[model samples]
Target: MKNVIKTIGIWLYILGCLVVGSVFAQDVHFTQYTATPVYVNPAMSGFHGSNYRAGANFRTQWNAVSTGNTYRTFNMFADFALGKPTYYSNYAGIGINFYSDQAGDLNYSTNKVDLNVAYHFILDNKGTNSISAGIQSGFGMRSIDLTNAVFANQGGGFDPLGGETINRERYAMFDVGMGFLWSYSPNKDRSYYLGTAMHHLNQPELSQFTSIGVSDRMYAKFSVIGGMQVPVGERMHLQPSFIVNRQGPSTEINLSTLVSYSFNREPFDKNSIAFGMMYRGPLDAIALLTRVNLETLAIGFSYDVNISSLSSASRSNGGPEISLVYVGKPKNRGSERYCIPF
Candidate 1:
């Protein structure tokens, strides 16, 4: 049964890779729930008003299994709101994110750095509704170190000895995305936000492996993101969100819901703490969530309970992730108003 399960899992992973599916479909960590920070839509950059936002996340996955199968990830991003309230008519932000992943004897490791710029233009601001068109430009490089990776030894590395020096390859790609956000309810207790983003407009070429004669292809991904908050009482609220990602031949869907109970009425100094839980589909896992807000600084943590086939081998450690965010409030008048358009 163990071997069968392993085989099935391997096949599923292969199918997921070969089918030209959504790149964002691969689940990595929990902080992705913050939604806005991940650039799920380019238009989200400065949608939250004139505030500087910074965040980071760390995820450790599959620790229950062998050490090699466990995955670790680290991410950081920051964004600034464009324009001043009294002199500006548009909103925009510039953001940069760095990510690194390690798995399977370090054979499957990925390092990426991305710089993105987003802009939002006010379309209409009716009583309580604000609509804007968001656009973003993404620049990044992805690299892999295959020296000690398990996959490199699968076929025979050098010849008879099955040992070959690990080779590293890196590639750079450009991505363009656009998003639309419709926000309603303003400063009310109950609010709703709707957002949609389409990414990888350039169909980034991820073909570092193709240099050895393997066929490689590039695909575009379109994502839809939206969230609604329903207050149960003065102290508690339920928030549900849906994410849809589609590639050329495959589609991945994620649906999650969380509840946050506040103790201090959303903190006046931008600093507070909240505890919550999340249900993520596709992988069918439950995670514990906690967040800290210190004025312009925010941090989040998530630990997953593996419930899928991987759980049997996971030994219950599943995956753990941590994320951090920093929003920079402008002290001067110059740095606060100059936002490069996406």
Candidate 2:
């Protein structure tokens, strides 16, 4: 049987979290970026036309080599928009998000709470064009459970405490991020947006050893996330989206296309179903996504197919993720609904 690789991988995962070894890691990510708009870019804090919105995302990955060891992530967020839909009216957006990420076996976890604020510059009364700027302040904490950790020299023992150390195992930090987004729509039916964000501006030092310069600080991240919506037919529409992330020495890119079939066209809320394929690279994986929308609520699901070098052990199976979004609409405000996410 093969046991060597799994052991090495677990150690690498631990080192990745500590950022003191050759390994380093990035922030948690989900395949359904559409469902986690505010988490992706603070500029999207109040991009939706609704008065308020809320959503959650969950993901579990990498159970191939070891069944008990995997990576899990969860995020929940909500945002509010207050303003009029007029060419001359300006608006302010506010949002809050909380997320937790944990790696199995090591029982390592990171949790963060974030506050997001944005200002939108309405270019026209029709809400055809607008630009937004946003800023984020957050608090983060990380820790590890050595009891579940399989360290060397234990001969794979089942000790309760596993090992002993004097270094601090948990710490917390304050984080800062900001971004800008621009949305443009020639008419009410077609729309697109492009945004860029910078995260980890303070470079939080994530070292379990409690040593400062010895370990590399969390790397600053510059990200580009955008999408477009186009109408190809009366009921069918083409939606393409992408997100590219660069943090420290790592890079991730995901591109997706989903076709939507509308069943009901409500001026304020639309009912539809969408399905599509996504390609994630730098040589990673492909995913299948499906989304359903009913009035003010939408649900999305995605399954990834492992295509990277680790596919052999993963058996080409990546992981599964689910996302939910809800928007609150109060009657009809005396304004035009212009923000459309295709």
Candidate 3:
């Protein structure tokens, strides 16, 4: 009886999510938003003050809920600057981003590829202030495996012979997004930036039951992100950041702060360690994050502890994520430095 109840509960939760997705909007989420810069905003591509940047991220969640009921996502990006920076100058950037996600026992999955471009306008003679405008175009595919799904009409138990019909299992769509950013930096050691983005401007159709005359369109998503870096001492720095996101009737906000200690005096040499904590508003979850910088490469890891109303079902286990980033400078411009590791 206990096993039956647990199975039923899991099914109910999955059903609720599917219903919400069809009626409202659904998008994949990540705890380490800063690590996946292009996903947060197209204007962030190549914003690291380097000649080129490459990054990858992976996340897995709900592993403790049930076997074969987990969710996973993978993302990768590469971006480069078009021109070298002088005291005051304009520049352009281009990038490519790809990501894939899979969730639930039904094997629902999404894959996307995007191309982005941005133009930067120098606002100060010292090149300390700038604005960036960017746009992105992408194609996405969503699929599901209905053969593994369990329906209420299948009785209270599993039965392979239960007959059910699902007309379609996959769909494809085109997507577009745009963003703007404003950055201020007195020098390399201290900086502040703010940006906003709008995604899914086309409201692409996502319904898999097209044969049944059901049409579902994905809602547009809007986001705002901001962060500031402060130098606490010669070797220590503090950074506070926040992100607000809204799609359809759902909304989320995340706040985080990080403290970094550099082992070397040279800012471009890249030898540092940082630790931070993040909170998802309205008691969603608490996360602990850490990063290590070595030369031109940096690696980060974070774990989330569930604290929401669903914690009882999740057993307080949320998710874990890992990220890797590489920032490279041209030989001619080796003296340039970035204000933050992420």
State each model's CA lDDT, in order: 0.57, 0.79, 0.79
Error of 2 at 206 (Å): 0.3
**TM-score of every candidate relative to the true structure:** 0.75, 0.89, 0.89
Question: Which has the higher TM-score value, candidate number 1 or candidate number 2?
Answer: 2
Off by over 4 Å in 3: 1-24, 155-165, 266-269, 334-341
Cα lDDT of model 1 by residue, 1-342, tens digit: 655654554445345444422343242444355633545655566544446666677778766665555667777666666556322355566666666766555335556555556655543333345555656666665555445533322354522211121111566667676777776644435567777777667776665434334434456677777776666777666667767767765565666666666566653224456666766656657778776666656666777887767777876556777766655666554333322111
Looking at model 1, report the run of 10 residues with the lowest lDDT sum.
Answer: 159-168
Distance (Å) between predicted and true CA of 162, model 1?
12
lDDT of 3 by residue, 67-86 (tens): 88688899999988787765
Model 1 off-target regions past 4 Å?
Answer: 1-31, 35-38, 86-88, 123-128, 149-168, 209-213, 248-250, 267-272, 329-342
Instruction: Go through the candidates in order and give the C-alpha RMSD of each one to the true structure.
Output: 6.8, 4.5, 4.6
Candidate 3's TM-score reads 0.89
lDDT of 3 at 282: 71
The per-residue C-alpha lDDT of model 1 at residue 291 equals 68
What are the per-residue Cα lDDT tens digits for candidate 2 across 281-314?
A: 9879999999988888898999999899999988
Backbone atom clashes (below 3 Å) for every candidate: 18, 2, 0
